[model samples]
Target: MAQAKGNALGALGKLTELRQRIFFVIGALVVFRLGSFIPVPGVNPEAMTRLIQGGGGLLNMFNMFSGGSLQRFSVFALGVVPYISASIVVQMMGSVVPSLQALRKEGEAGRRTMTMYTRFGTVGLSAFQAFGIAAALQSQTAAGGAPVVYTPGFGFILASVVGLTAGSMFLMWLGEQITERGIGNGISLLIFAGIVAGLPGAVSNTLGMASNGELSVLRLIMVVGLVLAVTAFVVFMERAQRRITVNYARRSGGQRAYMNQTSHLPLKINMSGVIPPIFASSLLMFPATAVSWFGAGHQSRWLQGLTQAIAPGQPLYEIVYAVLVIVFAFFYTAIVFNSQETADNLKRSGALIPGIRPGRATGEYIDGVMTRLTGVGAIYLVLVCLVPTFMQNYWHVPFYFGGTSLLIIVVVVMDFTAQVQAHLVSHQYESLLKKANLRRN
Candidate 1:
């Protein structure tokens, strides 16, 4: 108990040292929030609001993710979506493109280069999306028949394109700064902050619905209960891991012999974390978003079905979402943890899995283990994601607190806490080393 208290005090001291970093993150987030309210020039906020409220589906989900930035048609309306999409493309390319794959293997320098390319790609995506949004605004009409855009022209297009791309760049910079200096992941925290910002509004909206007798109290209770249950489930699944024992053979360096060291490899159940859902959501949003903007009117059966395949609350949508989650879980886990590479590294370091051969056999064994772990991970993700949808149907709830949001919230919190603990541990170790050095001197 005394030791634990000492460690806690040491952690607090280390956190004090990180005050500047914490403040930087807080400042960046405040800037992001402020940007969300600064509506784009010449855009009709009322008309946009009505359009969003009229038909709530994927757009609503996107708006939730953006922290209501899209609803306001803010300069930062596009959010970090473009960058995420660009990352997906880059990841795919890394698998197929030899140069890209080689770059990925080149360590930090290569990663830096890839990040730059992603930023460039984000600009391109932002421009395209901005034009689409601009065109959509120009075409849309208010209830009173006034246009959303004051003047539909090349100037509006250029301004909006620049504004959106610049906004994304700003957000990117904020995220990077946060990651470098903040207590948690800058990007995930940004997204989490955005979603959380919408909570008050969502709650108020729900209460308003209840007052007007549009939503029942029972339904509201069910929604709250379901959210809590889902949050707990996500935490459990996210924390689940497979521990593989490894033994390191120690050798004598002169006349002295050393005992073997042992460790365990922990393979997390949710290996992909929230990444799969983010990708799935972004990819699905693009065409539907384009169609809505284009006023394409959903003519073809195939197009309609395609849109339905990703629409919220639909079985088809849920199924596809689950499948995508599973696929990306395995895909991302493979990318993040290469079994062959791990095996090679372990072998090189004179470490081996207990009762397992040390080379190709070990690699294959590790791969098999990963495959099973990923399978469990995939199911856990799917279950966490699909439960909310089922609850909505069962209880006729109107709230949007589903599996994806819950999973994201839980996983991010866990990871952030772990990172803070790591920082604290490192600080403690440094202090101990310093004390020993002082004693020696």
Candidate 2:
């Protein structure tokens, strides 16, 4: 660990570009955190916080994703949720819509077109959700009977729609900039930042509980140990891959003499990464938020029941959440890592898996392996995401300790470190090349 730290520092010192990228990511995230305090135009931040503090529900999860922005009634309360939701819709459509599927296959042009569609969808979804939230706040009250919206009217709604929509759009742009200019994936890093921001507070609260005798010292120790163990497990699983050895065809007496060569096709155990949990949570949050908003205005038996049912930690909520996570794990894995395409590329490169035949047979074999791997991955996701909720219920573990939040934090950190390593390696290669050229000269 000490050597690893030294290597990172050494690399950052030598690799100016990597250091700049890391700095850019840090600066961008700090800006994001600051923006979380810029409140929405007409909403009462105190009242909103009171409403959240009153109980646990969808608000907790939303606040977690927004880095407490929802509780503050900030313009960024929506965060990148709209963007993510739009991505899900666009990707799903790309599968079914013939035109979209063709466009998706069109390479860079297709990507740009699909991205444009997703942006449009984000604006539309942002406006829609913004409207719902504004309208809902009109009827919502704090524990002290204060209205969440100070002046509920068309004016408030309009201002909110504009402010919130722009905030989401700005975040979308910010994330893109980070991806192009910084380290790791911009969107994932954004969500990771949000989740990480709340971690310290969660730790403090958990300790506070122990101090207050609400949680026994022994239980606290156990929770801490369990959390560490689970984190190690997550790291292990994320790094695990199924390696398929591909042997290249031997060539003799050609322009370039190519002897038999071997390389491994590395397929990650969780090829979908943290997308499944995040997407699953976003989907569930939407319907629950809608029901909560609508129920606030016109209270009824079913609506009240629904408000209770879909809240995180509820039986109905957990069951549905688990199912959605599993579904997305498989769906996204299929989309992102197509076994057929991988096999085709390998075949085109004159490589073959030792036991499997080339072409169609290879595709089938890889697909079969992927299917089994995805099943295991999906189960792992479900366990990681839901077990925290279970612990929160039974063990009273802090909110940040498990579930989607932990998964995202772990995965994003891994991705960022991997990118940094790659950059460092590239820098080393450039230095070697320069040295070789100098020697040759």
How far residue 346's Cα lies from its native spot in candidate 2, in Å, is 2.3
The C-alpha TM-scores of every prediction are 0.88, 0.89
**Candidate 2 ranges with C-alpha deviation above 4 Å:** 1-14, 250-258, 279-291, 296-299, 306-320
Give candidate 1's TM-score. Answer: 0.88
Clashes of each: 0, 0
Q: Give the worst 10-residue stretch by lDDT in candidate 2.
A: 290-299
Q: How close is candidate 2 to the true structure, as a TM-score?
A: 0.89
Per-residue lDDT of candidate 1, residues 56-170 (tens digit): 5566776777888988889888888788878878877887788998999899999999998898898899889888778767788756776777878888888898888888888
Which whole-number lDDT from 0 to 100 does residue 361 have in model 2? 95
User: How many collisions between residues are there in candidate 2?
Assistant: 0
RMSD of 1: 3.7
